[model samples]
Target chain A: MSETPDTLVEPALARTPLDALHRELGARLVPFAGYDMPVQYPTGILKEHLHTRSQAGLFDVSHMGQLRLCGRAADAAAAAAALETLVPGDLLGLAPGRMRYTLLLNDGGGILDDLMVTNAGDHLFVVVNAACKHADLAHLQERLGDRVAIEVLADRALLALQGPAAAAVLARFVPAAAAMPFMSYAEARLRGIPVLLTRSGYTGEDGYEISVADDRAETVARLLLAEPEVAPIGLGARDSLRLEAGLCLYGHDIDRTTTPVEAGLSWTLGRRRRSEGGFPGFATIRDHLDHGPTRRRVGLRPDGRAPAREGTGIVDGGGRPLGHVTSGGFGPTVGGPIAMGYVASAGATPDTPVTLVVRGKPLPARVVTLPFVRQNYYRG
Target chain B: MSLIKFTKDHEWIRVEGEVGTVGITNHAQHALGDIVFVELPEIGREVVQGGEAAVVESVKAASEVYAPVDGEVIAVNQALIEEPARVNTDPQGDGWFFRLTIADPAQLEALMDETAYQSHLEDLA
Candidate 1:
């Protein structure tokens, strides 16, 4: 279920009814997925990010992948186990209405994709990146086959209500939503519209991912946004928010050539999986976990206001190249520039000095501890 | 008498008495698409014509605003800082970014008038 963005118009690149709302709000619209989405509003990315941290932000994550995995009790459990074999996360213990973040791994232990898995009744509800959803499903089917049924829930939309005020704003629509614990999923009626509300989000802020039927998604979104605290945030704000929160972007931070361990996500691997060593590419993962990966992901703070964008070469003292920036931008919340990249594990310290070569200039940079801003996620 | 001035970078200046108002023409803001941030010079900062005066960053890119006439920044529209969308809202009215006290009144004659500036925008478009 993919659409070719090459054409002037592709119907599969679906449009949310709120498209008009964005234009009316003077959003800078760009083609993302198959639909036109606002990259940012007039307030700019930096301001939007700071606003989210100080208050709340509404994100139209409708383009995200939403799907359902169904099978008998024993079959579903087997499917979950098979999935767990690929990534370094525990899925078998995921109770219904609980969600866990994990990655899809290739046989070589490289990350194919990172996604969220939620236990919804007898089936597992999965949300992934729109661009990688097709490949992710193929990978799942190739491994699990008919033993577990997979259905691409094309009729659903995902909206991430993020930031400190997210709970307060959402509470007005779904009072029960405020009480749901973090990383847990709950089925609730949002203004009488059936929705899968999960206290999980990419932004480090306390937020919820509300999935609703395509027809009713707009209704629920409009209702939630009616609160004064909610602002129609765009991709630019979302990127900065995640960056400030230190969350990884799949293609940029983690890739098919990078294993989870090398990406500094070994913690996502359950303790049992580490001992059993039964998952695919377990040998390579265990080796990295035991001896440590040669390179690791770390946060970088650039000197001054100039942003060190992705692909910029990162270097050590004397201008010796070390790594490359994956994502870099002016962190609205941090009030400075920040970046993330893979650096030699030896030089990946909290205060290690590095330089980023931007436009033929060696800009001073330093490694800083992650989550540049403290995450305000509400546990409950 | 009021004198109008222009900067090669597309800023316009309209000097009335000792005070001058600086703004980016509708053409400039339209091309930028959704002004998100406007970094204005502090009041009382001295600047010369053709020198860097401020910065305007949009969602897609950033651009430097230039001084159209020699002046001392007397005031800045703080509203734009809190609501940058005003630039897109009214590039010539509520979008006017700052006012300056003319340091060299002679520099005003070098700018483009309404007719000339309109033609300049047409050529670029």
Candidate 2:
């Protein structure tokens, strides 16, 4: 965080393989998760956001951690079962080439992190958030080291080509990408550059997340950008897009203090896992599933243009405290302010009236269903 | 003749007699990105020089627009309520926030003129 004064000596920030490319494109770099990443480009955030919705947008998400886990003697079934011990997902039943979103919980049922686990036929591929990657790596090693051998893919870069036009654009380079089903993964060549492709994205759009070699990252990105339908997007638009998609940002919408059920992520808990109760915090999670949580995460739509920012207080019509906003901002797609926050479960019903205290003033708001905009995943 | 003066905080005031029109400078708007919301002070509210006067929100964050000089607000731009993008399109002309009765003309001397304000922006860059 840049909260420290400029006069004080700041720690050196890590740079991605595309650092020079970002600067060359006139990106305004800022400190994020210990990396100097681009927040916005010359096109600005508002335009970048709208562009990603209507057309294709290329994003550099290389700072996230990517790792591979293989069972001893290269047994993938054993690896999947070993991973099931740490997460609430039914990885053992997960089909090859399919990815499942899961959470890492502490013994107390509090969420430590959320990650995506993909069954790569012979091994398991996982992607974790940048800020929590180091801790996640340590936890995985400590708990499942004996059962699985973890290998960090530090030399790879992740890129996301997202939007309704993403499939068509990617088809020009790799024809198979256009036919891949949602949440499916494959390894293919993009115009001779070997890459891993996941027909999934954070923006709720039908797109692909590509993993390429660090040395070939810029080349692959440039190739994608050269397409007339694609534009370079930055972190600023990435945040708005995910928020509009009703996605949770780690360390914000969820943390060690909140549980998967409380975060409205109970769906990530597989049916078998729920009944078997083997993962960490299974008792508390099962309890929450049996009895509703005291507080629940819900979508909030402020009545006017003014956005209710993070940490803003949520109150009832009578000014009684309920909870505080975790992620809030203007949704360019919605053309108004949108927010997500925790509130008393009793008042979490859709269309329920609520008030947001922004800058000491009460702003009228209402609880609504999430994904303010419709999700356009490529189900076929 | 009207004269324009700027505060170090990027607010600009153009005086034409006792009433001065105030708004954030173009430089400020550029730094803030696209403007989405504007909160102006109530008419007839008295404000001190360098005190919080208005709020301008961009897609990313909100920023306070400080009063360049002590004054009493007389009129506010209602058009901003319907279309805040004016602050980005014409920050110097139609995007003015409010008009205030100058409480002390002497305060103008402390503000930076165009030449000084341009140099100030350069110093920041």
Candidate 3:
């Protein structure tokens, strides 16, 4: 769960294994989640965004926390069930090689973090947001210490190759990976390197997220970059791309005070869990689900050219304060200024006119059904 | 009767007689990334030296464009409204932000020339 950064107070900036490669590509490195990450490359954010939509872009997401959960008795189901207590996902029924997106909710139904859980047969592979990884790992340890062993996968680096032509480029290296459908994963050996390749990504594109050993990260990255369709994308385009997909950035959109239901993520909650109710904050979530949330996340498009930034107020016709924007920027694909914010549920419907108070000036904006653009995930 | 000067804030002023053309330096535009929108000053507005004159937004963030010297707003590049990315591709030539009528010629003395600005950039590194 990455947050839209307004400013930076760089502490001890940690470097990823691909740091040299990023510098070599003339990436503008900035402090993000305690890591010196590439905000953009020489190609610039707009071009990178367009490229990803039409072609492919490679993103180094090694800052994301990768972990493994092993049962004390070699029981994958037992481990998954134990994890179910922390998240609303029905992990106990999840088949191997399939993944489910879940939220780690606090007791009051607030999101602690959103993460992906993949049932890898023997153990569970989980990826959490970079800023929330430490706290998430500690939470897992305190909860499942007796039943399962939580091992942080610090030796692996994560890479995402995303866009329309991603499958063709990736297939050149690992032909088997081309057959993998969306949300499914398999362990594959490519170019003499073993990798865990998942057919999933954040950019609303058909792609794969590859987990490779730290030592061989550059080797795999070079092999992928050698493809004609793939280019190195920075966090700037990544933010814009995810925003166009109506995906929420962790701190900005959904925080400890925001519930998954309010964040428009009730779909992540499993049906069995919705009925049986056994996860953290289950009662509060159930109550919110039964009684519609007072406010909900909605997509906003300003009528003018000015980009409404994070924290811009959402107001009514009379300039009455309604809510605030959580994530706002120029979506290159949308060809206009786009934003996501929480407004009173009354004005959350599509085409509902509202004024976005930006820089003390109220500008015309309207609620739109999310995504703003079409998502092209591969089914086969 | 023309001269070029720079500000520590990364603005450039190209003086031609009583009128001065102003824009962000190429270095400044590069640092800002892709420019998405530009809010220009009105034609009759007066801008004080080092005061905010306009706003330039990029995919990353919004930055206030400060006037390098005191001047009266004369003209703005209307084409920039449709193609703000011009600030990145042609920051020096076609990307010139606004034309202003000089309020006081004395303000130019405090600014840096090309040599001094080049050294200033090196000093920042």
Candidate 4:
């Protein structure tokens, strides 16, 4: 058994083929997503984040959970239906090579996790964070047992190549990669190794996420890094990139305590599913969907350069507490400060003035639309 | 060129006459990761040694940059107000955080010389 304490504690360390490369890059390794991954590099988070937005950045994301679902046609469709019972998306309409983002709901309609499900020709490919993988797998098995074949792709590694020049940079090696449109995926070969490539990323840029066998991951990453456009980006840039993109971080922006509707993710719900109501916690979700929620997620723009980080309390003019910041940072791309938080539904409107209590000082903040920076996804 | 001294907290002070240019070390920037925002002190603000002089935040954590010596802020790096990552890119050069008029030139005794600070970082490694 190759199981060690570090491996057992963080599945990412045990799985990522580029783990050694991260160390070589002088990354400050930390336990994240059940794997020891680099949080930052010697260049620091701000530079890394900006560099990725301006150029191409390579990210080792092998710790994310990858799974394959297989069964007869009807059985697979039934399995999709079963999975849909827990999330809000229309899984039946998901075409082959296409992907959709959705949330896993609890019995109370609260979000358990947000995940991606892709229709791969003969099977469904699902990816989730390492921290939520075990629970998600158990939940899927519990709900759709015996009807579908659930297999964890433990030997595969995932890499996110993101930035403005991602397509141009990746095309040099993987020519077929340039053809994949945003949210679509395809199978290709790199260095004689067959791989799965998808046009998706967490950073607000055009990018591709490649899934390759563990043994060949290092070679592919090195090949990509050899290009002047590609640099190794750590978790720090990854966090800021996603934040600027206005995407939710699993633990911070989403948790068991928040519901899909409250998080502004009701669009993931399929029209047929909304009326059919077959999924878990459908009634609760429908109730919030129809009547609206008491609290909603809002984006905040601090007036000054100071950052209002997570856990910062937000208040009204009279100092009455309103909400707490879930995720906040100085967006390198937007060239200022931005934050996201949960506030009373009444206080959650664009241009609403609020105050962030940071270090015993109330900082001026204005409610703004999410994605402090505009996303530049390559639809074509 | 003047002798550069570093603090255990990672701020650096380079004395030239009665003024000292204060900024975080490259090692400090590397440790803090990506810098998203920097809170600079007002020009002419008087600060005591070891007191909070500024706040630097990265995507992961927020840290206070303490005054290396009792001084009066004479100038601040206004460039960081719009582009904070400049500190991460050129922390020692273009990223000089502030220029302070040293109140007591003798306070430099408490800091580490370049050799000593390099050894300290080596020990950490």
Number of the top candidate by lDDT?
2
DockQ of every candidate = 0.10, 0.43, 0.48, 0.29
> For all the candidates, what are their Cα RMSDs to the real structure?
6.7, 2.0, 2.5, 4.9
- Which 10-residue window of candidate 3 chain B scores lowest in summed lDDT? B26-35
State the weakest 10-residue window (summed lDDT) of model 4 chain A.
A1-10
TM-score of each: 0.79, 0.97, 0.97, 0.86
Clashes of each: 3, 0, 0, 10
Over A66-121, each residue of candidate 3 has an lDDT whose tens digit, in order, gives: 99999865657878988999999889988999998999989998999999999998
Q: List the residue pairs that clash in candidate 4.
A: A10-A34, A11-A34, A44-B33, A44-B34, A45-B33, A45-B34, A46-B34, A46-B35, A85-A279, A88-A269
List runs of model 1 lying over 4 Å from the truth. A1-13, A74-76, B1-125
- lDDT tens digits, residues A1-380, model 4? 01112212433345368878988888778777657888777776767888899999999999999998776574346557657767878988988888889888888887888888888877888898878999999988887777777899999999999998999988887887787879998988887888898889899889989999999999999999999988899887898899888899988998988888888788888899899988778888889888989989989999988889899999998999898999997787787778999999989999999999998988999999987888999876
| Superposed model 3: Cα runs more than 4 Å off | A1-9
Please list the residue runs of candidate 4 whose C-alpha ends up more than 4 Å from where it truly belongs after superposition: A1-15, A41-44, A72-75, A169-176, B1-6, B13-23, B34-36, B41-51, B67-114
Better of 2 and 4 by lDDT: 2
Tens digit per residue, CA lDDT, model 1, B1-125: 86666665678777789999998877777656556567788899998888878877654345778888888999999898777779877887789888999888777777777888778767754
What is the C-alpha local distance difference test score of candidate 3? 0.91
Candidate 3 local lDDT, residue A300: 97
Candidate 3 vs candidate 4, TM-score winner: 3
